[model samples]
Target: MTDNTQHTAQHWVATDYGDLDVLRLEETDVPAPAEGEVTIDVRAAGMNPADYKHIARSGDRDALPVAIGYEVAGVISALGPNTQIASGAGAVGDEVLAFRVAGGYASSITVPARDVFAKPAGLSFPEAANLLLAGTTASEMLHVTGVARGDTVLVHGASGAVGVSLLQQARLIGARVIGTAGEKSVDTVRRFDGIPVAYGEGLQDRVRDLAPEGIAAALDCVGTDEAVDVSLALVEDRDRIVTIAAFDRAEQEGIRVIGGAMPASATYRDGVRAHLIRLAGDGDLVVPMAGTYPLADALQALELLTSGHPGGKLALLP
Candidate 1:
């Protein structure tokens, strides 16, 4: 057996806050599991825009040498002392998916047991790793807006990951969704059971034509001024208009904001995590895979995600 106390693993670290150039690979000692924690042999790491945005937006005063990545899928290698349970929340050798880890862009990581869940057998490691964050964010937005059966809601940036999840979840909730996307993504939106409305000039008119009675709610994932304005014009209740991207305007315009940085996002995600997993496992919800890259090529993937909407989720094989 390997010496547990001396095992080493490689991880990606941001040497500084600027761009993808800041990322560097380095070998480090594997962390031991603490109480309520588990050591995972990471097989896949999901990449999202938030991974890079968090670094780019950090000020000079922020510390350097920060570890990057937040979501992963893997097998449990060890469990924390006193964490054994009759429920078997996370046992050694169990394949699992986890989120909000300190540094997921690694071959191995130690995370709180609460953050781990059994990865559904139906999903590959990449798909399971890509599921939670976007799914929960979409679910939380719908929850806060009180979307329900027979309601018609507008979704901005409907071709992106979170947007796709929102469209699927809204349909599962029995709500009608009118999603906005570029011409290239119109078909994608339609395939997911959303009414595809091309975004650009006259978007408001187009959406109005589709929903003559006005929308029941609006979700802005793009944060474009046009998106917020159109949503404001059509959705009568400011409380029903939520933006996952436009926090500044959401504050000024009295609309709700639900993003990772938002205080309430944690509670929402925790409550909905298991439900999202079940839905994905049952094929009631699907996360489209745009691309996959080896761990060493993560910077390229992040660059692509940062460039613009990539139409789906990206995964890093560790």
Candidate 2:
């Protein structure tokens, strides 16, 4: 087992919901696990677009001083009493990954055993850190859309983490995949075995030419109005179209949406988490992390995220 005390820990706290300037790096007390929980000495943390969106736009300043990260990959440090995680697959010192209910920006976090998963043997800490939120969201979309053999799937923002994941998972289900991205990311979408199409102006023509017969289902990982418009144009049924972004607008457009902070039921989250673990272990999933920033430089990481077009997921290493 590694010596847990020899390491120093740091956390990023956002004093108020604003820009990257709002985040502060501070030396905080290390966390301890409660029963049914395990404390992880965080090695890496993954950033999502929602992290910045929530900080800038969510307007609920009541949760000020909130830690700002959602996914982490680390080593098991301490475990709470009566926790199976302490004795099961992950004992003290085992490498692990977890999706936080909150507080993942810290150098250490206490996560419920159910929300933690054993990191796959060949995956690095940074790679595993990129999986949780985007991977699970993609899994859920596939399930909800009932994508099946011979179906033609269309994914918007195919160069992004969720879009790439959707492309791969849809392929695994025996579906033909076509994805939209900027012209520069066309190669990346093609690398994922998806037919690549450009995402602006003439998007409808590009998608129609690629799918030919029809697109059985569509997933919008990018919330652009163009993405929504193209999906509605190609798919005959609005129910078969889903958006991870544009939740408020999806309702108005009559398209199905998922994963906004709108009180998602526990059952749904559990099912999605299960699918993620299965796909990761079976070699059916891939999470591309665009870049990494030192934990102390979280502000820079947020800056990169806010700049947009990261090309993939962004992460922080402690």
Candidate 2, pairs of clashing residues = none
Ten-residue segment with the worst summed lDDT in candidate 2? 1-10
Candidate 1 is scored at a TM of 0.95
The TM-score of candidate 2 is 0.92
Best candidate (score: TM-score): 1
Residues 66-90, model 1: lDDT tens digits: 8888899998898878774212555
Give the C-alpha lDDT of model 2: 0.79
Cα lDDT for residue 286, candidate 1: 89
Q: lDDT value for candidate 1?
A: 0.86
- Residue pair clashes in candidate 1: none
